[model samples]
Target: MRYDVVVIGSGFGGSVAALRLAEKGYSVLVLEAGRRFADHELPRTSWRVRRFLWAPALGCYGIQRITLLRPAGRRGAGGSRAGGTGRGKTRAGQSGGRAGVLVLSGAGVGGGSLVYANTLYEPPADFYADPQWAGITDWRAELAPYYARAKQMLGVVDYPRTTAADKVMRAVADRMGAGDTFRSTPVAVYLGRPGERVADPHFGGAGPDRAGCTHCGSCLTGCRVGAKNSLPKNYLWFAERAGARIRPLTTVVGLRPGPGGAGYLVDVRRTGAWAGGRQTIAADQVVLAAGALGTQRLLHTARATGALPAISARIGALTRTNSEAILGASVPRRAARRRRLDFTDGVAITSSFHPEPGTHVEPVRYGPGSNLMGLLQSALVPGGPCRVRRWLAALAGRPRDTVRLLSVRDWSRRTVVALVMQSVDNSLTTYHRRGRLVAGHGHGRSNPSWIPAGHRVVRLLADEIGGIPGGAVTEPFDVPMTAHILGGAVIGATRADGVVDAYHRVFGCPGLHVLDGAAVPANLGVNPSLTIVALAERAVAHWPVKGAPDRRPPAS
Candidate 1:
């Protein structure tokens, strides 16, 4: 089949591209590797790992995909896959004294929104003003209207409920003298009455039906109540209404210039099906929106195999992780007054406070009975011999008694997880090695400090919440993990500096573009979903009207 534009990934970028391009009278096709999930199909909790995680090989249909990458050299190796349920069992070469970096990301039709905490944040001006941002255009000013459009489409609103965690965050801010900065986080969730289905308030009923947030705090597990404003609920919904064709469970494997030498040829295969059934499709334009990891892997493989040798050498450099950390404290119900701390009373993140410079922390929660994540939580002890000290401090006096307190059921209800992120400019690069991708801190710098200012805020939250400090899966393994992975195929002043231009067009490959996190030049110090959407809007705004006389070139 041939399309006017083929978008390879139905994420924030691809969804926006599809809607806008179709609105311009072009036929658009979105190929997503993950199955299309209805609200009822989403798992209520993470306990059913198979249904709550995205490992097609293992038959896990969930939205989260966790991988451990062992660095091949001094640079630390790690990569994260956050879009759809397609699985690859490829492995890397074994090495010594290497710490494995934990990568956490989302999958499925809505992309990261299927598992994201729904935080719709705009980074401070400093991010755009950074020297690494090589742009002739004033991006901040240019993206303002687009950002507003994205927020409206995603149903951005302040979290609806004030929970126990909210009060604790407020207290933490007051005590730290940054009280003014403490406020409820704006999220992409419907805030109408709980359990009530409502007309599309944002789109005047033109969009899909939505349910009000139930305050279950299971936004990460997948918003089964349909309260979360994932891509499918907005952009993709409108795209379909506009006649765009969305093919879920279809994975793009390779791309080359079309036989006539003007468009492109894309090879695809059914995600869960066996081999030898690849199908090739033709397209006048191809927008690479498979996200940071997916796009990078595709381009890297294509370049290596001589599929697109014009791809820049800077393909896998400067992948940003928002300098983030997921650390929190778990309070025992017995220690709380009347055991009244219900951790699941609001959206995934309710309130946030800045504990120190370059640090931002938000109180995160999960719904009751969705306590499977408690397994990754361990007592937090900073510095040397963390593992041994953590166990010793957690037990304190009686090991047997403390063990019961660590039970998943009680731990989740009593815990307030802090989703800590930073604006500090630290990054790693991803490389294709031995048929697989590996991430590592680029040479000439020590490993990026994964737990810096964030740890201090974690400690403070533990004290205020009346809980023991806890660590995420990465901290125990002595590595780093981040949900907002940005960059890799970043934009730059010229082709020599980056793979894509400021308009998101591939430098040497006209009629081809990358419009996802892969093109992000730097970390936005916030959830990157909104930024990606706005950028896609900007990219599509420049798209020529279908069947128009040749005006601007397809790519600069």
Candidate 2:
């Protein structure tokens, strides 16, 4: 059977598309390459190591190797697969590729909303300043309503400052004279009296019944308590109720545009820890919402093999990592072991700091069970012969010092995980090599303005909290890791400069569209998921449904 639309990847973008398209009375088939998890099936405690972190045994997390190549698309430093078992199967159960795509995206039914920190913010004005974007769409105006719609649907709320971590961080900021910089961040968490269920509090009761946050601190562990709002709780949930079929662990490998005016043929596969199988899907329109890494790999492979040769030569050009850096500092030794310090119990990201003009800093928390502290401490321990001798001497003189020092201490009181994001724009491209994605060349000059600005904020955090500043020690040659990767297959004025048109449609491929972070024209200096959702809503509004006239007239 054919579908009106086959959406690839079920993350934020695809989830919204599936819901809206299905609500319009179309047969929408969502193909997700990851497995599905029920609310009850999610891990309850961080100590449940297998389930807490994305692992093959838990049927979550994809272990794909990711390498960063130079801008010239030539050789650069290669990296190893970071963590987790390189096991499990796709929906088709196929395996055996280097795990270079180490993104923390949601693979199952809910998508990244399930795994991501629930920080949601509006895109800044600079986002619409691109000349290329002005020709195709008026993003600022077109997306305003959709942004409000998405916020309500996601149950976005202000974080409560109840936890010890929140209190201490605020005190530190106040003491350091940067009190104005620290404020409660907007989050997509349920915030009402405990166990009180309300139906669509944001909407006019058209959405789901959401129980308020219990402050379980399990937001990162998948919100088993139903307090953390994710797409599965609203959009996807509503879509299913409206008759959309969400096929998890079902990976779409290839696409063949149909003959004449027919739609497209989508090649499918299965994945998990099990064996593999294959199938085909016929659809009149295809929405590629497979996240940046997944979609780039698929489209690059298709172009290499001439499957869709009309794809622009600029397919993988203009990529961006959103100028993000995950800088963290451990809590002081005295505060380490307090059970009441439960970092995971409050909002995932409570307060933010803007010490400079373009940079934004926010507090992030990880449960003790996450072992993130151990990693940070290990990295902070000074190295070299003096360090080794000092460690040995300390071990002999103060036997338990090392372990005790590493213990969960009053540090959470003074410590805050500040996620530094900047408006200074920088991006990397993508290319296919031996059937995998390697970072494209042209690693632009590190945005000097943003770096100093971020450092100033970190210093302010240190001064306010009486804590040490910390982050990954990258050598002069090493690149930083970013969670917010965007661009590539960007929307451009013409097919010559981009893969898609301003309306996000593939120039030559009439019915295909890309509606995700990949299509963003510029860095919004903020978390992009909200903006992406709004853009998808706008794209769907422009979709030529049964009753609508085509917005763009056909070739003359």
Candidate 3:
């Protein structure tokens, strides 16, 4: 049987497409490569690695997925491979890449929503004014209504309460003379009484019932508290009610034109299986929402293998990770235990402030039961000219701090991990080399490797919060980290510039669309989930209903 539309991943973009298209009376099938979870089935903490991490090769089928990327496509820097386009050579002004850039993503029925902090931020003017696709439309104006729609659908609101973490963040902002910039984060969570289950407050009872947020600070581990508004609870839920079906563990490997223009034949298989579970299915139209990594990987390999040769050469030319850094400020374990300072008393990221121009910072946390991420931190060590001297000096200054961070089992509960993002653009060109993603720094600013402002902010934050300021273990070298990876199959006016058109339609592939983060053309400088949803809302608003051409949500 041929589906009217088959969405390749059930994240923000795919979920919105599934709902809107299904509401239009089209048969929609969402194929997700990860498993689904009932709220009860979701892990309560990161310590349950077998249930929280998604390393299927190791028999773990969970939501969190970590990908380590290196430059020049070199494999063995103890890195997990990032998918790339085809083999290629770089011209002058680019050479051996940075040490490592670790990307964190999610794998589940709801995609990255399963693991993201519930922060929802609208991109600033610079994002809407970006030169890449600025000429196409007045984006801020165009996306305004859709952003409102997205906020409503996702149950977005100003964080209802301030916790200890928020107070610290506010203090930090005030001390830095940026008090006006400090505000409780906009979040997607039910703000009902703790643990109180109520009928759907969104969609006029058409969506799922929700329980109030418990302030468990476990949003990143998966919201077992029924508070965080992951997509499965809203968009996918309504899509299913509208007769859309979802198939989990069904990964699409390739796509080829169907015989006589019937559409496309999508090669399918069980995701992460070492053996055979391959087959093919037919679809009249396809929407690729498998994310920046997954979608670009498929398109690149398809183009390389000649399965989808018309795919543009720019498929993997531009990938952005918000030019982010993961830094930490944690009181020592002994002091933390004495004060009983639980950083996990609020939502994952409750407060944010801009400490410097072009940079956004949000304090993040995890609950007591989850501390695995502590493995990534170490005392801050300045690096640049005096490498050996700096290391020894850092050890002398913060020697006990490193030991405390490493030895603390309740590190997650004691620390706030501040995510710092810069509008200063930097990028990676990801392509397939020797069956793996070969990534190299693309043309852009080089400061992503070392955001001096971000380091200063973290150090100051530590001082204010009564702790030692350190950073991700990879920060000393090439390990910049980001949870918001975006833009590979980006928008362009023609096939020569990008793989997808402004409407998200593939430039050369008819009836094909990329409606996920991968299709985003500009750096958003904030949590990108809301923008992705809003963009998808606009993308499907242009789709024809089953029997007519009249607009559904009315064209933007």
Candidate 4:
């Protein structure tokens, strides 16, 4: 089937494109490689592997996807599939480029929105001043209107009330002598009456009704209460009503110039289906929004096979991790029980603080009964023995405190996760060697795994709450972990410098666009979703309708 456009990966970028084009009377088809889930259909806890993990070969199809991005050196030995999920899986290798980076991204119709804590933030001025694309335009000024419009469209608002986690963050900031920097986080949610259904709150009667946030703290596990402002509830929903077709569980594997000047031919296959179910569809334009990893993987394979000969050699340049690190602290169960502070009482992330210039720290949570932290976090310092042996020995030495911090069932209520990011200038390169996408240190120094300012904030957070400190498992290996992955296939001045132009149109690939994190030229110190949406709004605003001149965007 042919359409005006075919968008791969309905994430922040693709959702914006789908809604805007469909609203403009264009034929749009959004091909999502994951399943479409209704609010009621989402998993209630992260412990349900069959409903929480994204492993197709093991027959466990769910939202959260964890990919082990091995360094380029360890390639040959670990390049084998996990039974049959297609891409060669590498045994988690030692710290290296993207430095021992482990990618935890969302896989579903709404992309990362299916799993992201709804905290929304705009990057600091440093993000705009990066030399890579600073000369392109007055970016901060140029993107201002688009950013405001995106916030409105996303239903962003300040979290209405405070929670135990909020107080802890406030205390942490005070101790840092940065109390002025602490504030309730701005999030995409309906902060109306908890669980009460209300008419369309964002769009004027054009979007779906919503339920107020229940402070269930399950936002990360897919907001079963229907209050979180996920894409399907807004952008994608409006696009569908305006005639956009959403085909889920369909992965695009190949792209080339189409026959009879149809513009482009997109080769696709059913995701997780048996082999040989491929099909081709034509479109006048194709937008790649399959996120940082997904889009880069697809483009690398295409260019290597001569399917996209004009692709720039800089396709993998300047990829970023937002200079992020995940560290945390947990209160002892006895103390938590006495103090009656439930870390899991409010939304996933309710408050944040900046300990020093360019450093941001936010407290994150998961509702009761969700203990996936047991899988992602380890003791802040890895030492004498395995984590199990360490925990067992510690339990024998300090039973109450050890059991309080280590209990799987109570981890959520007793723990506070510190999401740290900085505006430091650093990046990495991605390669599609040996049929797998791997990262290597690029440009400046490798991304920082230890930020003194960030760790100081987490430590203070733990001390204030009277808890034990822990960090990302990969941290001890001199690597960072993050959910906010950006860059690769970035915008540049010319075909020789970058893969795309300032407006997100590929340099040599006509009618091809990349509007996701992959196109961001530099590291954004905050969550990148709002930036991706604003960039898409700016890019698509330049697209002229079929057989007509481009119309001016309405004033905000």
What is candidate 2's lDDT per residue for 1-556, written digit by digit as tens? 6998989978888988898888787899999876667666666544464454445545544312123433332352222111111111111211111112223345567777776778889966766765546655676887799899888878777776666556666665565466787778788987888767777675577776778777655566577667677888778888888788999867778988776758998998776435558788899989999887777777888789988877776766656666565565554555433433345557667777565545666667754354433333322222223444554565467545445435544433334566667665445556677777766332333212124444445555555554555543321123454567777778777776677776678878878888887887666678888888888887777666655677764521
> Where does the lowest 10-residue lDDT sum fall in candidate 4?
81-90
Instruction: lDDT for model 4, please.
Output: 0.80
User: Per-prediction count of colliding residue pairs?
Assistant: 8, 37, 4, 1
lDDT of 3 at 281: 82
Model 1, residue 242: displacement in angstroms? 1.0
The runs of at least 3 residues in candidate 2 whose Cα sits more than 4 Å from the true structure, single-residue gaps closed, are 46-49, 55-102, 135-137, 166-181, 198-206, 259-261, 273-275, 332-335, 338-342, 372-415, 446-450, 459-468, 473-477, 553-556
1-556 per-residue lDDT for model 1 (tens digits): 9999999988889899999999999999999888889999888788878768778877776778776655656543442322111111111110111233566777778788888888988887766765545345788998899999888888888865678889888887887888988888889888888899988877888888888778888898898898888988989888998999999888888999888678999999988777776899999999999878889888988888888889988887767676677787777666753667777778898888777655688888887778887787765545334455565765686564456446676566788888777666555667778778886654223123345556666677778876777676446445666677788898876766678887888988878899999998765667778899999998888777898774544454
- In Å, residue 422's CA in model 2 sits off its true spot by 1.1
Q: Tell me the whole-model lDDT of each prediction, alpha carbons only.
A: 0.76, 0.64, 0.81, 0.80
Q: Per-residue lDDT of 348-426 in model 4, one digit per residue for the tens? A: 8888888877778888899888887655665564322254465446547766655555565577888899988767666
Ranking by lDDT: 3, 4, 1, 2
Runs off by more than 4 Å, candidate 1: 74-100, 333-338, 383-406, 443-449, 549-556
**TM-score (all chains, Cα) for each model:** 0.90, 0.82, 0.92, 0.90
Error at 236, model 4, angstroms = 0.6
Alpha-carbon shift of residue 210 in model 3 (angstroms): 1.3
Pairwise lDDT winner, candidates 2 and 3: 3
Q: After superposition, how far is residue 154 of candidate 2 from its true place, in Å?
A: 1.8
